[model samples]
Target: MSKAVKCLILLAVIALFFVTELIPLAITAMGGAIACGLLGLIPAKQVFSGLSNSTVVLFAGMFVVGGAMFYTGLAQFIGNKVVSAVGTGENSLMFGLMTVGTVLSAFLSNTGTAACLLPVCLGICASAKIPASRQLMPLAFACGWGGIITMVGTPPNIIAAGALSNVGLPSFGF
Candidate 1:
């Protein structure tokens, strides 16, 4: 079969597996990648090339930092301060949470920012008697917006910068 046809079939299978969720998404993705390499659709080296990408390294480092913050109760301390500063009104609380999420995500991965702030957001919601549903979506949207504010804020931005450099175009600067 042509490589393109093989790739299409592989993508279809991966999509089916993802929708069914019979196996972990990570496993399904990895398995599909390996199958492509084994089928000669992609180079073996290329298949794992992203493992060592700088963006991946950055993500790993940020995950560790976020985990440390959670373990040291720093996240909770910050959460408390933010909640107290904003008071119990739902609009004020939502605005504060989104602003924090956006600011943190501008310097760190959105996933890391969300992870670090999730418990704090939950605590604030519970303590203030605000339903989590009202604030979490805003927090998520703010994180996404934050990613566009800096070159290193998200993997897609980093990847796009790399692609530009590969094509002999100047990369974006912070």
Candidate 2:
């Protein structure tokens, strides 16, 4: 068959997979790569190469470092001191949430930072008789926005930093 025909077939198969929803996303991803290999769409080696990409390694390393910080109770200690000084009003809570998100994202994934603080924000909402869904979004959004200010703040930033490093630009120094 022609390359165009094979491409169309692959596209149809992917669309069908989505429509049918029979396979888990992980399985679908792997199976898609395998299918491409079997169909000779690209070399199998190319498909697996991304698994060892430098960016992936950097991400895993940062997460482990962040986990160590959490495991040592350093994060909790700092949070306690800051919260004590700042008070637990809505603005304080918002700033706390945003700062936590920013600092944590500097050493962890932004999504991970958000997931970590979500419970705390919810607790504040419960105790203060406020709606959690409202306050937490701004806090989370601010963290997400603030993450752009540093290299290690988010995976995309890390990747950008790495790309800059490749071209001799100074890194954001984490």
Candidate with maximal TM-score: 1
Clash pairs, model 2 backbone: none
Per-residue lDDT for 30-68 in model 1, tens only? Answer: 998899899998889898888887778877887787788
Off by over 4 Å in 1: none
Best by lDDT: 1
TM-score for all models, in order of appearance: 0.81, 0.75
Candidate 2 TM-score versus the reference:
0.75
lDDT of 2 by residue, 92-159 (tens): 76676677677666566777677766766676667667677777788678668666767766778777
Assess candidate 1 and give its TM-score to the true structure.
Answer: 0.81
Prediction RMSDs, each to the true structure? 2.5, 3.4
